[model samples]
Target: MKLLIYCLNYAPELTGIGKYAAEQAEWLAMHGHDVRVITSHPYYPAWRVADDHCGWRYQREQRAGVTVFRAPLWVPHTPSSIKRLLHLASFALCSLPLLAAQWRWRPEVIFLVEPPLACSPAALAFARLRHCKAWLHIQDYEVEAAFALGLLKHPWLELAASALERHALMHFDRISTISSSMLSLARRKAVPDERLVYLPNWADLAIAPSASSVALRSALGIPAHAVAALYSGNMGNKQGLEILAEAARLLAGETGIHFIFCGAGPGRALLEQRCQDLPQVHFLALQPAEQFPALLGAADIHLLPQRADAADLVLPSKLAGMLASGRPVIATAEAGTELASLVSQFGIVTPPGDAQAMVRALQALAERPARRGLFGAAGKAWAASHLDRHAVLARLESELRRLTEGGGAGTRGTTLEGLGEK
Candidate 1:
């Protein structure tokens, strides 16, 4: 099967959607399928394009048997709502020619990863033109998330965006999302039940707690006896990371408890500023892939703070790795939400942005080594059963084969008119 994946982020971006996109593409490629990815340069979780890809030029490379095309886009140093829209628009406009270039390729499946839903219309149109399967894998519901998070407040804009999103969503041959809650949202947007796929992000169950973790602890100056509460991954607005700093400050006098904020993003500067006075707090840039498992192992507790509004809008991709690392997690999520339910299974769940509650949870876990061990074991077991990378990708590959082999049951012969455009 020939598959073309359209996404805003891709490999060499240590965390978030990019890592998963790269993995999926490579996995398919390695499994004897022809996979190609059209994405922007590595500029995520940091908001700055890598120096090697820092120009407005289209570049192509072969990564792990997959062909990747990188399109240039504007990266805002600090992404506000309007700036973010412009950023997505820039990529949508710039990548059009690249999308057109794939016309001769005639891919069997045009797989799109959404966050930058700006590119949806083009992908749908091109897929329709070629009569191929248009598969949309939503990592985040950008439009709804923006509005719910108060990032885009204009009533008219919200109406327009929501209408566009629903139209695009309804026309896709298949729509997959990372969580069941998100798949339900897609169904609410009128996507048929058969078209919605629950494609959760995967975990590399091979990443066991390793001896390198001792070396990492020493390098970070984390005392052997101190409990390291680590928050590792994209430091973004949706993360509600301010609460982490506040929690760190409140626990400053607890010498045996240390806070390590690892990763990069536009929010990093503000997070650093907030943690400057807290001696027990430390910040590290995102670690390399090889060091990632050890980094997760170094943490006695993983901190996952999320904004209440973003609770159901987006599920953190980092949670899989945290669970796979056999570490107990302290996640901020509202009751009854998917995130809260998942974390509650093996760790603690606190209300979003409640610093006191987060601190209390951290203290409780830090004080009970046996309880932490039990939670860690349960988390690892859960990850192994549900998030095994090979099993997840194999299921996806089977779906792709089914879609390409004409076995999909989604509504077909969808016209441009169905998108509410003449």
Candidate 2:
């Protein structure tokens, strides 16, 4: 099977959507599928490219087995609506012309990633134009995500965006999400049950932790003595790092447990400032995604905290990475979160944002290090059986194959009849 993935973020960008897209592309290529990724120049999480790729507009690169084509973009990385809209518009406009040209030359089943729903229009149109089918990968319910972050305000705009998303999902060949909750939400909004698929985040074996290093520990100033509770990923608003800070406030001056957060985001500076006044907490800025295996290998325990509102639309993408790193997760978020399920699926959950509970769990895990093995073992077992990248790409391949083969992929309406299940 030959497939093309169109997304706003891709390799070199450390955002959730970027990582997942790259992983799937790599796996499909490895499995002998002809894979191509059409994405904009790298800039995400922090919204700025690294010092090297600064002036480069567009280029083609090879990642594993995938053929990657880059396009120029002018959107700022920050969250302001004007800049975001510009960014979205730039990708959609730039991507469409190239993708349209690419289609004429080399057509394949296209997969569209949401937010920059503008991107979806072109990919969807191109698929239709080519007399082909496309699968829409819905990660977060973007409009709801914005509302969860307190960015969405106008009710009419919400309705319009909701309608647009529904139209896209209903018309697309298949719509796969990262969680059951999101699948339910997608159905409620109007996706046909058969066309809908649930493709949760999976651990990248290539990125899992290797042997622990004393040099690595010393380099980060992590003492050979202290018990470390690490949160390594985005420190964005959706993560509810403030709640983790509240947990830190409760554990302040405690000698046994320590917190190490390593990642970058719009919220990192605020997080650093929040922890500065509160001692016993350390903040490290973002590291390269390539370094994840070694960087995350050192955690004694992992923290996954989501803003209660965030759990609805945004699944903590970091959970997959954490689980893959072979460490036990200590997650606190809204009830019923798929991530929180990792804690239970592995049997180690505390209520969302409860400082006392976090402190106690921290102490217990600190005192008994062997439980980390059990947690990690469960995650590895589950991931290997269910959520590995290769498995997900296979499921994706099958779904897209069905679409290309004119198999069953029905659409649903607002009434949601026969939706959310198939």
Candidate 3:
């Protein structure tokens, strides 16, 4: 079947959403499905395009067996309401003509990855005109996140936004998201139970480095003999990075323990500014995806840090990669979250943003190599069984096919209650 995936960002963005969309498109294309991605020029977390990329109001490129449509867009710097609204408006307008151009083929499925913020309008329009199945692949819930982040402030505007979000969601033929929490949120918005699907975040085992330790140590310039505890991925308002900085300071001079903060974000510059003078802590910019496995794999402990406030909205996709890299995790999310539950089930957990607790947990594992090795094996085993890239992509493909195809066994056997129940 032909598939058109519409998202705000694509490869090179260093976002979990970009990685998820890229892997899905590539896998589908490799399986003989024609996949085309309609996306904006790559300028994410930083909100600016590459220095050397050429100008094009709109363009298309074939990358890794997928045809990608690039539309002109602006990246918002401060997350201001008006600036973000404009960014969404620009993409919404751009998709108008792009969708008109592709409406001829009427692709069998239209996949929407919401982020640039106006995907709802563009996707609903395309699916309405083409009369094709539109599937929402929600990485984050925008309005709720916007309100939580304090970007959308007016109470009346928030209500209007919620209504608009629900209206669009109801129009889609089928919907899928990364976590069960998100699925529940979607259902609460009057999404019929049968139209919603559970699609967890996934990792590509083939590309995940089997021995990331030595390679990561060499790349980061850490001595062949140093123990590294790494925290990579976005450092944002939702991530309580100050806790990591505090933990780094608390663990200073504690034999053989080094804390490395890899990846860039809004909070990274602040983290570096506050941590530059420290000897036990190191700050590094984000590496290319191919280089990430080693960086993640070589870690003595893979640390996940989140603000106590953000437990409901975001689930760091990098965790799966850490699991696939065969590293032991020291996730510090609060209780009642899927992350917290998973950590309790398979790894270590601590109160969100508790520096002293994090330090204590790291030191305990450091003192016991057997437990560290056991956790590492457990993580890899769980990841292979559930979050393996091939299995996840195939499962998604089957779900999408189920939505488009006329007949098949639906989500009856699955924990999902809504999807296929229609």
Candidate 4:
């Protein structure tokens, strides 16, 4: 099968959607499928393009058997609502020629990743023009999230954007998202039940603690007995990371508890400023892929904080890694949401943005080594059963094959029965 993945982020971005997008493309390529990616240069979680990819021109490269085409875009140093839209628009406009150039390739499936739903129209139109299937995999519901998070406040604009979103969504041959709640949202947007697919994010269960894990802990100067509470991945507005700074401040006198904030984004500078006076807090830039597993293993507890409004709209991709790391997680999520339910199974869930609750949860786990061990074991077990990368990708490949073989469009919605509970 020949597949073209259109998305705004891709490889070398290290965390979030890019990591998964690149992984999927490479997996498909390795599995005897022809995979190509149309994406912008590495600018995610950091909001700045990598130095090597800063040139304002189109470039192509081969990565792990996959053909990757990088299109240049404007990345805002300090991204605001308007700036973010402009940023996404830049990619959509710049990548058009690249998309058009693929006319001769005539991919069997055009798998579009959302967040820059800005590119949806072009992707859909191109798929129609080539008589190929158009598959949309939504990692984030940017239209709804923007309004819900107050990133865009005009009611009229919200209505207009939502209408446009629905129009684009209704035209797709297949639509997949990372969570059941998101799938439900797609259905609410008038996407037929038969078109919705639940494609959950997956984890690499093969990752394990190594010598580098100990080295990382030592290098960070975490006391031998101290509990490391880590919040790793993008430091973005939707993360509600300010609560973490507050939680760290409240726990400042607890010498045996340390906080580590890793990864970069528009919110990192503010988070650093807020934590500057907290001696127990430390920060690190996003680690290399080779060191990521070690970084996960170094944490005694993983912290996942989400803004209440952003909850359910976007599930953090980092959760899979945290669970796979065999570490206890303390996540801020509302009751009844998928994130809360999942974390409650193997870790702890506090109401979103509740610093006091987060602090309490951290303190409770800090003193209970046995309980921590139980949670870690349970989380690892769950990840192995439900989030193994091979299983998830194999299912995706099967779906792609089915779609290319002309069996997907009218099929019933793929149930999550074996993957996990709805």
* TM per candidate: 0.96, 0.89, 0.92, 0.97
Candidate 2 per-residue lDDT, tens place, 1-422, comes to 77888888887777578988888888888878888888887777777766566423667789998888888887465667546666777777777666866765555688888766877767778888887778788887787887667776768867887777767876887887777778778878766687777777777665454554345566667677877788877767677777677778788878667788788777788778778876567777666666667777767678887767777587778777776767778887655666565467653677766778878888877777788678777776665665677666676677666777788763223121122234
Give the candidate number with the greatest TM-score.
4
Q: Which residue pairs in candidate 4 collide?
A: none
lDDT of 2 at 269: 82
Q: Name the lDDT of candidate 2.
A: 0.73
Clashing residue pairs for model 2: none
Which lDDT tens digits does candidate 4 get at residues 269-290? 9999999998889999999998
Error of 4 at 124 (Å): 0.8
**CA lDDT, candidate 4, residue 419:** 79
- Write the number of the candidate with greater lDDT, choosing between 2 and 3: 3
Worst ten in a row by lDDT for model 4: 408-417
RMSD to true structure for each model, in Å? 5.2, 3.8, 2.8, 1.6
Residues 1-422, model 3: lDDT tens digits = 99999887788677667878888899899999988888878765666676655334688889999998888876666647777788877877776677778877789888888764466767777787777888877787878877777777889978887887877787878777776677777777877667777777787564343456576666557775566888888776667888888888787777478888887666788888878777778777777877776677668788998776667676778888877767678888878787888776556899987888998888888778888788878877777777867777787888878878854432432332222233
Query: What value does the lDDT take at residue 195 in candidate 4?
Result: 76
RMSD of 3: 2.8
Alpha carbon deviation, residue 159, candidate 2 (Å): 2.4
Ranking by TM-score: 4, 1, 3, 2
What candidate 3 gets wrong by more than 4 Å, as runs, is 54-56, 206-212, 219-225, 408-422
Per-residue lDDT, model 3, residue 178, is 71
Better of 2 and 3 by TM-score: 3
Candidate ranking under lDDT, highest first, comes to 4, 1, 3, 2
TM-score of 3: 0.92
